[model samples]
Target: MAQQATPVRTARLGRALGPEPTAVSGAVLLLPAGEEISARRPSPLLATASVRALGRRLSRTGREDGLVAHVVHYRYRGWNGPEAHLAADADWAVEEVVRRYGDVTVCLVGVGMGGRAALRTAGHEAVNSVVALAPWLPEEDVAASPEPVKQLAGRRVLLVHGTNDERSDPELSFRLAARAKKANRDVCRFEVHTDGHGLRQYRDEVIALTEDFVMGAVFGRALSRPVQDALAAPPPLGLRMPLAAGFGRSLRH
Candidate 1:
């Protein structure tokens, strides 16, 4: 006689880390750049000071404002070629935030592959805003998600791309913006004319532009003129451990 074993689910997902230890009023999910070629956790792009420091600062601000800042580490480097994996992961993160906080709002920010993932996920019920940075649009062969505007009618969206980007075409983003605008979305498209995909030459500008938009879109507050003028002033440095979770079977990871 043979004994039957329990069934195991086999869906791949992503990891989530939060700055908010408790139920938050709102949240922002930060996603990194990567592709099917490399689904590395905390993509190398995230290791850079420009990206890591920005995550830290954004987390700190989220804490101060009763918001949660969750950074996602995807299990697969590819978007849903047919399964919508990244979009599903992002949606799961948003659902988790709302589940804990109750009617909580959400925002998304992503770079490269993450950027496309953000758009794909923007249609989630809890997402009110999204910021895509130097997003790498997909080719015709790829089933990138539907035009985000159709899913995110009332949501706010900001697309920032570098004119000199050699890795991706900024024109694609511009066209997306136009599409969003035509759909009656609250969309803003910004161009960093001299920067490339990493936005190396204009990191500060990217940070300011994004943070400002996230605050307004989710929290209804962008920086005031005085604060904007003083953004160059560095605040005291502090550190905190992130509240880590993964998708599906290993959520607590």
Candidate 2:
């Protein structure tokens, strides 16, 4: 007899910050990065720290909008090949949010490998939008199938990549964004020049862009000129729109 595959355990939703569940008008599920291959149960993912910090910032930004933020703690520590355990964790998180909040809109925000998970899970009914920061997309080849973009339809999507990223290739994200845009015109990408996979150099600017996109998607607010332009512009130009310095500061006015 063949050995039975081990069933994955349920993912946990980290304590949220912001409005109470009963009062939340919108929610953001934050996903964290992980390794390429590992099945070890994640006692505590280091990547969760940064994403939690981001959630706190977003929670504050969307306080007036009644947006609550939750971090997803995956059942496993890695993407784990085609199983895509991270994406499954994200899906569970979305479902839990829906069960708790009932019809409230949701925005998925993730970084690195977690970004890939957010994009993969955006097809969920509760997810109105997704923000992928330095998403790790597999290179297309005979051995590796390309990530599907059809799932992104009817959902607003934003991909941010650092041009100087030493880990995940920025070009790969550009290609994915181009494909996703064709599938859903709402999809757009931004390039942070000279930064790495972490996008730390333009952290504030990236966060600002994310906040604007998430809030607009959740509350039907008007998007900034740059985002609107990027979404309306054609290929290459839209996929490679530069994230300018002081971009965050500019949003204040």
| Cα RMSD for candidates in order | 11.0, 3.1
TM-score, structure 1 vs. true: 0.73
Residue 244 lDDT (model 1)? 17
Model 1's alpha-carbon lDDT is 0.63
With candidate 1 superimposed using the best TM-score fit, by how many Å does residue 188's alpha carbon deviate from the native? 0.6
Q: How many residue pairs clash in each candidate?
A: 2, 0
The alpha-carbon lDDT assigned to residue 229 of candidate 2 equals: 93
- Candidate 2 off by > 4 Å: 1-8, 19-22, 43-45
* Cα RMSD of predicted structure 1: 11.0
For candidate 1, write residues 172-194 as lDDT tens digits.
Answer: 77666666666643666666767
Query: CA lDDT of 53 in candidate 2?
Result: 72
Local lDDT at 146 for model 2: 85
Write candidate 2's Cα lDDT for 200-227 as tens digits.
9999999889988887889887789899
